[model samples]
Target: MLAGDGKPKHILEVNGLRKTFGGLTAVENLDLRLEYGELRCIIGPNGCGKTTLFNLITGNLKPTAGRVIFEGREITAWPVPEISRLGIYRKFQVPSVFEGLTVYENMRIPYFARMKPSILGRSSVSRNEHQEIMELLERVNLAGQAGELAGNLAHGQKQWLEIGMVLASRPRLMLLDEPTAGMTIAETKITADLVQEISESSNISVMVIEHDLGFVKEVARKITVMYKGSIFREGTYEEIQADKDIHDIYLGRHR
Candidate 1:
């Protein structure tokens, strides 16, 4: 739907999106479309507007101009909560949750949404919710610490909890940024498996922004390469890794 104005749309669409800040351009005339349940990755060098693009998508920052359509609705400039309520949940690079709350307590929190209200969500979900939560925890290998305080958990556990919190809301699209930051190789592999399970287990679309080529290649089905606030190229993981221009761009030869 188009906010208050009722309408349906393709899962997600960004047509000619543009964002400019005074002297600097963050995202310029960008066009992006997401199919239902597709796992898409976004990669770029520093200052290439990756986060800015995310901000625009999550309503953290408004684009200078563009049309943002989600599930057949217009949310180009919608606020965070509104966008979230519309089933587009987002996760940050850093973990977010009630540190003081135990894992059980954290999962017991209330649910918030404008549509499809399930009195029991991830925290306090019933059989289905509980099953999903348990599966997610186990999938990420965090079941052993389900009763521990969210703060008492390890760094990787904390990250998993934040992901669990987002799961509690049952979002249709997940925006993940550097989910494996500071993690070891084994941990990163585990997390990647969990992400894969999530994709295989549901119809949720994932738009991941990550820097590690190996990591992205592990989970990404398609990759969108960004530079200078616009898309440099989009292709398969192998295509991006072997791209001549990408190498030049990384070698400081592309301007």
Candidate 2:
């Protein structure tokens, strides 16, 4: 839906979203809107419902209440594959690449999945598809290692490879859960750069859940702080960092 300014409205919207596991509430009454092509970072302490929110949006878990709207369509409770086909893709905290396959081979999986070739016969990539995969690998900085086994890549490289694989699906919204969980300072910075570049260069909207404050500061255009299953604060990095209450809650100084 276009707003008054004639610009596209939120690419993804979560309204009064809630989730519970028996007696425990994981996410509650959370409302979020991600603008088209925006890069937003979500930060909070452990057990703050960060991953649960992702699960709900990606259809890994059905919400106990509320709705998930993507590009003006309500997708709440849709199956995982159905949501993925609707241009919403997510990367979990762990790198889920195909370790047995070469990097190039891993890239081919999503590309072909999107192509949906005939089920009656085997399919092969045409010249244009091959070029597209190579271009995607280049974007993820994995062109040089395309022939290497995915298992042979370093930790950060594996993460990048998984990201590239997600990108191969041509998603409109990318949910990254701790894309830099285990990375050196340098790799984290590179990841920040890559994410920023992707958001700026493409129409994809990125929502990242991260614990690394430094990484968050580097990449977040806007920050959402989650606490005890709800949004505690939303602002620029500096504004969030300056709020003493946010710090206290994040550090467990005041439970």
Write down the lDDT of every candidate, Cα atoms only.
0.79, 0.91
TM-score of each: 0.87, 0.95
Candidate 2, position 223, lDDT = 96
| lDDT tens readout by residue for model 1, 1-255 | 243455443478987888899989989988887777788888888888888888898899988988888888789899888998887877788887789988756654524332255533433346765676676667666778888988898887777777777776778999888788878877777778777878889778888888777688788689899888888999998898788999888777895
Model 2 per-residue lDDT tens digits across residues 1-255: 688886559888899999999999999999999998889999999998999999999999999999999988899999999999998998889999989999999998886676545652556767887898899999888999999999999999999999998998898999999999999999999999999999999889999999888898899689999999999999999999899999899779965
Q: At residue 86, give the lDDT of candidate 2.
A: 91
Q: How many backbone clashes does candidate 1 have?
A: 3
Residue 103 of model 1 has an lDDT of: 77
Indicate the residue-level lDDT of 164 in model 2. Answer: 94
Candidate maximizing lDDT: 2
lDDT of 1 at 53: 86
Clash pairs, candidate 2, are none
